[model samples]
Target: MISIPICSKGCPTGMLSQFLLSRILENYPQVITNKNVFTLLQNEEFYFNCYQIASILKPVKELTNILEARNANLADCFIGLIKLGAKINQIQPGNQWKSIIIFNYNRRLGEFINNINILAYWLHPLYRGFGLKQIALNKIYETASILWHDLGNSEESCLNLLMEMRYWKRKVVPYDLSFNSIQETPMKWWLSINVQENETDQLQELALLLFSIVPSQAVCERNFSMLKWFLGERRTNLTLLKIESMAKIRSYYISNTDKEIHFRNKNLSEDELRKSIDKSVVTYDIFENEILERNENLEQENLNRSEENTEDENISSTILNINQFVNLTLPEFLSTGNNLFESITNRSNINERNERGNMEYNPISLAQRILNEENN
Candidate 1:
């Protein structure tokens, strides 16, 4: 017989809800359908599709086998999902059979984070909805299988594995705190000890949620509290850049935002950097160019003296090596500082200004953009 749906008390109106109503008709054909579908749903919530009945049956057996593999049970999955604030009535597909997701307190601080967390708290579907439903079913099956293997034995071996799995799962589950009585306390205490010993970033995060009921419920609010001083309570028209800047500033302080601009102009241009290192041994110093004629005369006299009598060959070799050592070590020795980049940039800027002053051409054009840009 063809299946049709009428409105129900529980599911007021929705396509999927109607689809479920139709499914009820197909399952229990004996049930009178001319009445409103809501009446039928109120009478009974479950419906079976006879044609696909065998398909559902085969997996239950497989699920039984998996549960026996480990000492785990439906109750354990139930408890796990319950701690995550998921309702019992979910019927969709996959792990989403329970919609609840376990996120850390820090993760739920965003506005959208609260929305998602709220949605996760709703009822589960009968079957997992996505393509991965079968896979999640298999995983849960595997989890159950492993659970049974260790459930009765209590050999400490299986129990330990189960405990560890539970521990890991609890950590992954968002908003779940029931398992904390078992392991969460000690883990937190140990963490506090670490925090006391050394003030690390993780400690800072934990400190934010020491007494929190939900993940970062107050964190976003607290962050925005500062901005409230600058903005109205109802203001929602902020530009993205300003909002982002405020967020970054709140998160990391001033050092992060100014770091780029601080380095941009402060850094020496490639041309200036290359010219600073006098690569040409034969090049004349600009200041010394006026003395070139006078130096040439002096050099001729010195050459005559050198041709007549020269120093030892060993002495010349030693002088050459010493010059190389000075060339290399002098640059290195001059560069040492707490922040090499800042120091170098400062020095470069000063030298550049000096160079601009000494240039024979127009100072405006000769000066580096960094200095002249501000001037202009």
Candidate 2:
């Protein structure tokens, strides 16, 4: 006869079982008659080890939850990984599991950290290129320029984009405004820039494109899962058009209402139903274009990776510098009352700003004044 394991190892279930087993041994020793199980449950060291493992895994669990969220983006993923690494590094040196956890973490982190994530981290207004090395920053710029060219922009426009990025980094003129209102909304902040120059206009468009990208395929996977539910065995006869209409309506209703949609057999007017579907439906051409664009981006990314492999040393150095900078600055940044969740959760601070008002708040001048005060 095959034996079924009581609990799997290295999981939350195992941790819970360990805790409960300890309690069970204390309360009802007669329940667990097996001497081996009894001996294991009674061991205080086992419980301690379980607690240690749980504590080590907690930050990783939290990071997973954050990344799985709908609003989570590339910037969140980048920062989350950095923070996770930092938290793991803080584990007591004497802890037996510390070395094992660090080894696994570093291996996984190397796989996840790439140029796209680095670019997203640099672009986010909260950090604003704060912790990135010049080499890493240059790589991001090069990536952006390449993407710009691939999008059918002229050489002059690409150069202009590079120039505009410099102004943004240095907080010059229109870019130097107090952007507290839209600090969390990077796309909106980029859109809100009212520069008359064509060069800055390209920057705004590029920023929007970069920030609008979702970090993972979770949303797409979710949609497919929902579609599967909608097209169960009984509903297999439904036409493609009808299925598309139903999916769009269901998505719209759930997004706006945040409630379960119950479909009931009713005598609905065909005209009204058609109008609703038409409002939510996307054109087939648009879907095709999106697919093509994604394929092209994937191809470009593959090409970029092959080229980047030639300069692995520089890339490795850049990553090391980024980690060091994050370790040093993240605590100070958090101490200033700004945090990761604030950007995700807080939306009340977003305000409409006029061009004149935006131009009035010069962050560069403000920084100079602060420096002067400190020198005095």
Candidate 3:
């Protein structure tokens, strides 16, 4: 069997492999003698199933890519999940694959989504709580109220914020017919809203803050990677202040221009260099305490989540079982381990292959054994 390299985009590999196998079977009939291979690849229904599966998963793959983007926000993630759910719901009713996908999607949604995500979705001008359930709307209001109070706003201000939210949702005057087009970015539109009244002030502030938050830590991870390059073995003695200045300069240059910045540029002024160094020094002092406080809050949140998980061990176990069941039933080739079927098909005898005195790993057999064990 020829090995096919999996594409990073999606499981187009199934269709590609199917086509390859068909061509091979047609050209070199003697190459494949296994009845299982013929049945799996030669049947017209097999082709249709592969096509259906790919079509169904296309939107999910797109959503995953969107959410992984550097500029993606909580609102983008929340809206994407809701749209993906709706897309899944539109699939043929009796599809086993659809049911499994939906089950896993909902499980992940429950685990990952929080009040902040809901609030971000609600605050997005494009979505404006569209397609959200009444319960979700209530949760959004609750989260907004809590955030308002946390920011040290008075109770009266909190009430005003909620009222403004209602007005915004209904597209009332000031919130209605914005000067900017709806096609503009949500944050830009929020900034452009020039209502003379101060009723929506708190809501605007909160929306901007929420929209400013990146949905993922991709930027931080990239910065860490860049830091590793800067702190290589030859540069181990570099001071933190110098490293900070270098990182900020690199970031600014990257943001402003596609061209690379030369460190030895003769046009650079001494005053500009001194100013940059001084800015990093001042920023380090200014943000150090805020960073510490943010870390403490993150630790507390993790501790609370740990406590909640411990209290709901039974529920967690049940979810685990459901996950296991879904993984067993779904086509394993579509997963990260695309070589499962290839390994099984290429091996004539499982006993012939041994790793560290253990039998060869066959997911099909393993799944059956697990099912039997669970039944017992």
Candidate maximizing lDDT? 2
Error (Å) of candidate 2 at residue 292 is 33
Candidate-wise lDDT, in order: 0.32, 0.60, 0.58
Candidate 3 segments exceeding 4 Å error: 1-28, 91-96, 178-183, 197-200, 222-376
Model 1 off-target regions past 4 Å?
1-34, 37-42, 46-187, 192-215, 219-241, 244-376
What TM-scores do the predictions have?
A: 0.17, 0.52, 0.53
Q: Tens-digit lDDT track for model 1 on 256-282?
A: 434533543446654553344224312
Q: What is the lDDT of residue 200 in candidate 1?
A: 28
Better of 2 and 3 by lDDT: 2
| Ordering by lDDT | 2, 3, 1
Model 3 is weakest, by summed lDDT over 10 consecutive residues, at: 340-349
| TM match of model 3 to true structure | 0.53
**What lDDT does model 1 reach?**
0.32
Residue-by-residue lDDT tens digits, candidate 3, 23-117? 87888788778889877778877676556667557656766766676656677666555545544545554454665665566557766577798
Cα RMSD (angstroms) for every candidate in the order listed: 35.2, 13.0, 21.0
Off by over 4 Å in 2: 1-56, 179-183, 197-200, 217-219, 222-330, 333-338, 341-376
- What's the C-alpha lDDT at position 102 in model 3? 58
| 1 against 2, candidate with superior TM-score | 2
How does residue 328 of candidate 3 score in lDDT?
A: 25
TM-score-sorted candidate list, best first: 3, 2, 1
